[model samples]
Target: MGPITVTDDLARIDLDVVHRWLSTDAYWALGRSRETVEAAARGSLSFGALVRSDDGDELVGYARVVTDRATFAWLCDVYVAPSARGRGVGSALVRAVLEALEPMGLSRVMLATHDAHALYRRHGFGEPAHPEWLMALQPTPAASPATPAV
Candidate 1:
Protein backbone atom coordinates (compact mmCIF):
# COMPACT_ATOMS: atom_id res chain seq x y z
CA MET A 1 0.00 0.00 0.00
CA GLY A 2 1.18 3.47 -0.74
CA PRO A 3 1.78 6.03 1.97
CA ILE A 4 -1.43 7.59 3.23
CA THR A 5 -1.60 11.36 3.36
CA VAL A 6 -4.26 13.05 5.47
CA THR A 7 -5.48 16.53 4.73
CA ASP A 8 -8.36 18.81 5.65
CA ASP A 9 -8.98 19.93 2.10
CA LEU A 10 -12.71 19.45 1.58
CA ALA A 11 -12.16 19.49 -2.16
CA ARG A 12 -10.04 16.36 -1.84
CA ILE A 13 -12.91 14.31 -0.40
CA ASP A 14 -14.68 11.81 -2.63
CA LEU A 15 -18.29 12.15 -1.50
CA ASP A 16 -19.56 9.12 -3.41
CA VAL A 17 -17.18 6.85 -1.55
CA VAL A 18 -17.92 8.56 1.74
CA HIS A 19 -21.67 8.24 1.33
CA ARG A 20 -21.40 4.58 0.37
CA TRP A 21 -19.20 3.83 3.34
CA LEU A 22 -21.34 5.69 5.85
CA SER A 23 -24.80 4.85 4.54
CA THR A 24 -24.18 1.17 3.87
CA ASP A 25 -21.33 0.00 6.07
CA ALA A 26 -21.26 2.30 9.07
CA TYR A 27 -23.64 1.13 11.78
CA TRP A 28 -24.18 4.59 13.24
CA ALA A 29 -25.15 6.04 9.91
CA LEU A 30 -26.86 3.20 8.15
CA GLY A 31 -29.26 4.40 5.46
CA ARG A 32 -28.10 8.00 5.82
CA SER A 33 -29.10 9.96 2.74
CA ARG A 34 -26.76 11.48 0.17
CA GLU A 35 -28.24 14.90 0.71
CA THR A 36 -27.51 14.61 4.40
CA VAL A 37 -23.97 13.50 3.72
CA GLU A 38 -23.39 16.37 1.34
CA ALA A 39 -24.81 18.83 3.80
CA ALA A 40 -22.69 17.43 6.60
CA ALA A 41 -19.55 17.72 4.57
CA ARG A 42 -20.42 21.23 3.58
CA GLY A 43 -21.04 22.20 7.18
CA SER A 44 -18.19 20.44 8.94
CA LEU A 45 -14.42 20.39 8.92
CA SER A 46 -13.84 17.46 6.60
CA PHE A 47 -10.70 15.39 6.24
CA GLY A 48 -9.58 12.83 3.72
CA ALA A 49 -6.82 10.26 3.73
CA LEU A 50 -5.39 9.70 0.26
CA VAL A 51 -3.04 7.07 -1.05
CA ARG A 52 -0.67 8.34 -3.65
CA SER A 53 0.46 5.92 -6.32
CA ASP A 54 1.41 5.90 -9.95
CA ASP A 55 -2.30 5.90 -10.72
CA GLY A 56 -2.73 9.15 -8.78
CA ASP A 57 -4.36 9.80 -5.42
CA GLU A 58 -7.18 7.63 -4.15
CA LEU A 59 -9.22 8.66 -1.12
CA VAL A 60 -9.31 5.76 1.30
CA GLY A 61 -10.50 7.34 4.53
CA TYR A 62 -12.62 10.22 5.77
CA ALA A 63 -13.60 12.13 8.93
CA ARG A 64 -15.43 15.31 9.84
CA VAL A 65 -15.48 17.51 12.91
CA VAL A 66 -18.25 19.82 14.02
CA THR A 67 -16.57 22.52 16.04
CA ASP A 68 -17.02 26.13 16.97
CA ARG A 69 -13.23 26.45 16.41
CA ALA A 70 -12.90 27.85 19.88
CA THR A 71 -14.60 26.03 22.72
CA PHE A 72 -15.69 22.54 21.69
CA ALA A 73 -15.71 20.00 18.89
CA TRP A 74 -17.36 16.76 18.07
CA LEU A 75 -15.48 14.32 15.93
CA CYS A 76 -17.66 12.07 13.81
CA ASP A 77 -18.11 10.12 10.62
CA VAL A 78 -14.66 8.58 10.77
CA TYR A 79 -14.22 5.72 8.29
CA VAL A 80 -11.45 3.92 6.51
CA ALA A 81 -11.88 1.79 3.41
CA PRO A 82 -11.59 -1.96 3.90
CA SER A 83 -8.52 -2.02 1.74
CA ALA A 84 -6.85 0.54 3.99
CA ARG A 85 -7.66 -1.09 7.30
CA GLY A 86 -4.75 -2.23 9.48
CA ARG A 87 -2.45 0.07 7.57
CA GLY A 88 -2.67 3.01 10.03
CA VAL A 89 -4.79 5.12 7.72
CA GLY A 90 -7.39 5.77 10.39
CA SER A 91 -4.72 6.81 12.86
CA ALA A 92 -3.13 9.07 10.31
CA LEU A 93 -6.44 10.71 9.54
CA VAL A 94 -7.21 11.26 13.21
CA ARG A 95 -3.77 12.60 14.00
CA ALA A 96 -4.09 15.08 11.21
CA VAL A 97 -7.44 16.15 12.54
CA LEU A 98 -6.15 16.73 16.06
CA GLU A 99 -3.17 18.63 14.74
CA ALA A 100 -5.43 20.87 12.74
CA LEU A 101 -7.54 21.63 15.79
CA GLU A 102 -4.62 22.17 18.12
CA PRO A 103 -4.42 25.84 17.38
CA MET A 104 -7.95 26.46 18.52
CA GLY A 105 -7.12 25.24 22.04
CA LEU A 106 -10.63 24.00 22.40
CA SER A 107 -11.67 22.90 25.85
CA ARG A 108 -12.92 19.55 24.58
CA VAL A 109 -13.25 17.29 21.58
CA MET A 110 -15.61 14.34 21.62
CA LEU A 111 -16.39 11.32 19.52
CA ALA A 112 -18.55 8.21 19.74
CA THR A 113 -17.33 4.84 18.56
CA HIS A 114 -18.52 1.29 18.95
CA ASP A 115 -15.22 -0.57 18.42
CA ALA A 116 -12.43 1.94 18.16
CA HIS A 117 -11.87 2.65 21.80
CA ALA A 118 -8.30 1.43 21.82
CA LEU A 119 -7.45 3.47 18.78
CA TYR A 120 -8.91 6.61 20.31
CA ARG A 121 -7.37 6.03 23.71
CA ARG A 122 -3.96 5.94 22.16
CA HIS A 123 -4.64 9.51 21.10
CA GLY A 124 -5.82 10.75 24.56
CA PHE A 125 -9.54 9.97 24.36
CA GLY A 126 -11.03 8.24 27.34
CA GLU A 127 -14.23 7.62 29.21
CA PRO A 128 -15.81 10.91 30.13
CA ALA A 129 -14.49 12.31 33.37
CA HIS A 130 -17.97 13.12 34.52
CA PRO A 131 -20.33 10.62 33.00
CA GLU A 132 -23.15 11.88 35.19
CA TRP A 133 -22.74 15.32 33.73
CA LEU A 134 -23.40 14.17 30.23
CA MET A 135 -26.67 13.19 28.64
CA ALA A 136 -28.14 12.69 25.21
CA LEU A 137 -31.52 13.16 23.63
CA GLN A 138 -32.14 10.84 20.72
CA PRO A 139 -35.66 11.35 19.47
CA THR A 140 -37.42 8.13 18.57
CA PRO A 141 -38.67 7.85 15.03
CA ALA A 142 -42.11 6.82 16.27
CA ALA A 143 -42.41 10.04 18.23
CA SER A 144 -42.53 12.17 15.11
CA PRO A 145 -46.23 11.71 14.39
CA ALA A 146 -48.73 14.15 15.81
CA THR A 147 -50.49 12.84 18.86
CA PRO A 148 -54.22 12.97 19.59
CA ALA A 149 -55.43 15.59 22.05
CA VAL A 150 -55.05 14.42 25.59
Candidate 2:
Protein backbone atom coordinates (compact mmCIF):
# COMPACT_ATOMS: atom_id res chain seq x y z
CA MET A 1 0.00 0.00 0.00
CA GLY A 2 2.14 2.83 -1.26
CA PRO A 3 0.64 5.36 -3.67
CA ILE A 4 -1.34 5.42 -6.89
CA THR A 5 -0.44 7.56 -9.86
CA VAL A 6 -1.76 7.88 -13.43
CA THR A 7 0.48 7.93 -16.44
CA ASP A 8 0.02 8.35 -20.20
CA ASP A 9 3.28 6.94 -21.46
CA LEU A 10 3.46 3.16 -21.46
CA ALA A 11 6.86 2.74 -23.00
CA ARG A 12 7.82 3.63 -19.43
CA ILE A 13 5.33 1.05 -18.07
CA ASP A 14 6.13 -2.38 -16.81
CA LEU A 15 3.74 -4.38 -19.00
CA ASP A 16 4.63 -7.80 -17.57
CA VAL A 17 3.08 -6.83 -14.24
CA VAL A 18 0.10 -5.24 -15.96
CA HIS A 19 -0.30 -8.44 -18.00
CA ARG A 20 -0.45 -10.48 -14.80
CA TRP A 21 -3.41 -8.42 -13.63
CA LEU A 22 -5.16 -8.96 -16.97
CA SER A 23 -4.54 -12.72 -16.80
CA THR A 24 -6.53 -13.02 -13.61
CA ASP A 25 -10.11 -14.38 -13.73
CA ALA A 26 -11.85 -11.59 -11.98
CA TYR A 27 -14.68 -9.09 -12.62
CA TRP A 28 -14.38 -9.20 -16.44
CA ALA A 29 -12.01 -10.20 -19.14
CA LEU A 30 -10.83 -8.42 -22.27
CA GLY A 31 -8.90 -11.46 -23.60
CA ARG A 32 -6.18 -9.12 -24.81
CA SER A 33 -2.65 -10.21 -25.63
CA ARG A 34 0.64 -8.69 -24.53
CA GLU A 35 1.32 -6.93 -27.77
CA THR A 36 -2.16 -5.50 -28.07
CA VAL A 37 -2.12 -4.21 -24.53
CA GLU A 38 1.24 -2.66 -25.13
CA ALA A 39 0.06 -1.22 -28.38
CA ALA A 40 -3.06 0.21 -26.79
CA ALA A 41 -1.11 1.78 -23.98
CA ARG A 42 1.48 3.15 -26.28
CA GLY A 43 -1.11 4.55 -28.63
CA SER A 44 -3.46 5.96 -26.03
CA LEU A 45 -3.75 9.65 -25.42
CA SER A 46 -3.80 8.67 -21.74
CA PHE A 47 -3.08 5.60 -19.65
CA GLY A 48 -3.51 5.30 -15.84
CA ALA A 49 -2.10 3.42 -12.89
CA LEU A 50 -2.55 2.56 -9.22
CA VAL A 51 0.70 1.38 -7.71
CA ARG A 52 0.18 -0.22 -4.32
CA SER A 53 3.65 -1.53 -3.62
CA ASP A 54 6.11 1.25 -4.50
CA ASP A 55 9.35 -0.17 -3.11
CA GLY A 56 8.28 -3.50 -4.50
CA ASP A 57 5.86 -1.67 -6.77
CA GLU A 58 4.46 -4.19 -9.15
CA LEU A 59 1.87 -2.70 -11.49
CA VAL A 60 -0.99 -3.79 -9.18
CA GLY A 61 -3.70 -2.07 -11.18
CA TYR A 62 -4.20 -0.19 -14.41
CA ALA A 63 -6.71 1.49 -16.76
CA ARG A 64 -6.26 2.83 -20.26
CA VAL A 65 -8.16 5.40 -22.31
CA VAL A 66 -7.63 5.97 -25.99
CA THR A 67 -8.49 9.38 -27.30
CA ASP A 68 -7.57 11.93 -29.89
CA ARG A 69 -7.48 14.52 -27.02
CA ALA A 70 -10.61 16.11 -28.40
CA THR A 71 -14.26 15.12 -28.52
CA PHE A 72 -14.12 11.29 -28.43
CA ALA A 73 -12.40 8.69 -26.31
CA TRP A 74 -12.78 5.08 -25.33
CA LEU A 75 -11.83 3.56 -21.99
CA CYS A 76 -10.46 0.02 -22.16
CA ASP A 77 -8.68 -2.83 -20.38
CA VAL A 78 -9.17 -1.65 -16.79
CA TYR A 79 -7.83 -4.10 -14.23
CA VAL A 80 -6.48 -4.56 -10.73
CA ALA A 81 -4.18 -7.36 -9.72
CA PRO A 82 -6.10 -10.23 -8.08
CA SER A 83 -4.11 -9.88 -4.89
CA ALA A 84 -4.89 -6.17 -4.77
CA ARG A 85 -8.65 -6.42 -5.28
CA GLY A 86 -11.22 -5.17 -2.69
CA ARG A 87 -9.11 -2.12 -2.11
CA GLY A 88 -9.76 1.15 -4.00
CA VAL A 89 -7.16 0.45 -6.66
CA GLY A 90 -9.67 0.11 -9.49
CA SER A 91 -11.55 3.21 -8.44
CA ALA A 92 -8.38 5.20 -8.09
CA LEU A 93 -7.09 4.03 -11.43
CA VAL A 94 -10.30 5.07 -13.13
CA ARG A 95 -10.27 8.42 -11.38
CA ALA A 96 -6.66 9.12 -12.17
CA VAL A 97 -7.17 8.38 -15.86
CA LEU A 98 -10.29 10.46 -16.11
CA GLU A 99 -8.86 13.47 -14.28
CA ALA A 100 -5.75 13.51 -16.43
CA LEU A 101 -7.75 14.14 -19.59
CA GLU A 102 -10.24 16.74 -18.38
CA PRO A 103 -8.05 19.57 -19.60
CA MET A 104 -8.29 18.31 -23.16
CA GLY A 105 -11.95 19.39 -23.24
CA LEU A 106 -13.38 16.10 -24.42
CA SER A 107 -17.03 16.09 -25.37
CA ARG A 108 -17.36 12.65 -23.81
CA VAL A 109 -15.43 9.52 -22.90
CA MET A 110 -17.13 6.21 -23.63
CA LEU A 111 -16.32 2.71 -22.55
CA ALA A 112 -17.66 -0.85 -22.86
CA THR A 113 -17.41 -3.15 -19.90
CA HIS A 114 -18.60 -6.69 -19.45
CA ASP A 115 -18.82 -5.96 -15.73
CA ALA A 116 -17.77 -3.23 -13.21
CA HIS A 117 -20.47 -0.77 -14.16
CA ALA A 118 -20.63 0.42 -10.56
CA LEU A 119 -16.99 1.40 -10.61
CA TYR A 120 -17.58 3.42 -13.72
CA ARG A 121 -20.71 4.93 -12.22
CA ARG A 122 -18.77 6.14 -9.20
CA HIS A 123 -16.58 8.07 -11.58
CA GLY A 124 -19.47 9.73 -13.44
CA PHE A 125 -19.74 7.26 -16.30
CA GLY A 126 -23.29 6.58 -17.40
CA GLU A 127 -25.23 4.42 -19.76
CA PRO A 128 -26.80 5.99 -22.81
CA ALA A 129 -30.60 6.12 -22.70
CA HIS A 130 -30.83 5.37 -26.38
CA PRO A 131 -29.03 2.04 -26.22
CA GLU A 132 -30.91 1.05 -29.36
CA TRP A 133 -29.52 4.06 -31.15
CA LEU A 134 -25.99 3.00 -30.38
CA MET A 135 -25.86 -0.42 -31.97
CA ALA A 136 -22.59 -2.26 -31.62
CA LEU A 137 -20.83 -4.91 -33.66
CA GLN A 138 -18.59 -7.36 -31.87
CA PRO A 139 -15.17 -8.11 -33.24
CA THR A 140 -13.96 -11.59 -34.12
CA PRO A 141 -10.73 -13.28 -33.12
CA ALA A 142 -9.69 -12.91 -36.72
CA ALA A 143 -10.64 -9.27 -36.62
CA SER A 144 -8.77 -8.71 -33.33
CA PRO A 145 -5.97 -11.15 -32.86
CA ALA A 146 -4.67 -11.13 -29.27
CA THR A 147 -1.28 -9.93 -30.30
CA PRO A 148 1.24 -9.98 -33.07
CA ALA A 149 3.52 -12.99 -32.96
CA VAL A 150 7.12 -12.39 -32.10
Tens-place lDDT per residue, model 1, 37-139, is: 9999999999999999777889999999999997778889999999889999989988998889877876667777666766776666655335432211111
User: lDDT per residue, candidate 2, 1-150, as tens digits?
Assistant: 666666666754688766656755533444657786567667775354646453654566677777787666677777776777777878887777767776776666677766666676666665433543221221222333222111
* Candidate 1 segments whose C-alpha is farther than 4 A from its true place: 128-150
Top-lDDT candidate index = 1
C-alpha positional error of residue 21 in candidate 2 after TM-score superposition, expressed in Å: 3.4
Q: Which residue pairs in candidate 2 have backbone atoms (N, alpha carbon, C) closer than 3 angstroms, thus clashing?
A: none
Whole-model Cα lDDT of every candidate shown, in order: 0.79, 0.62
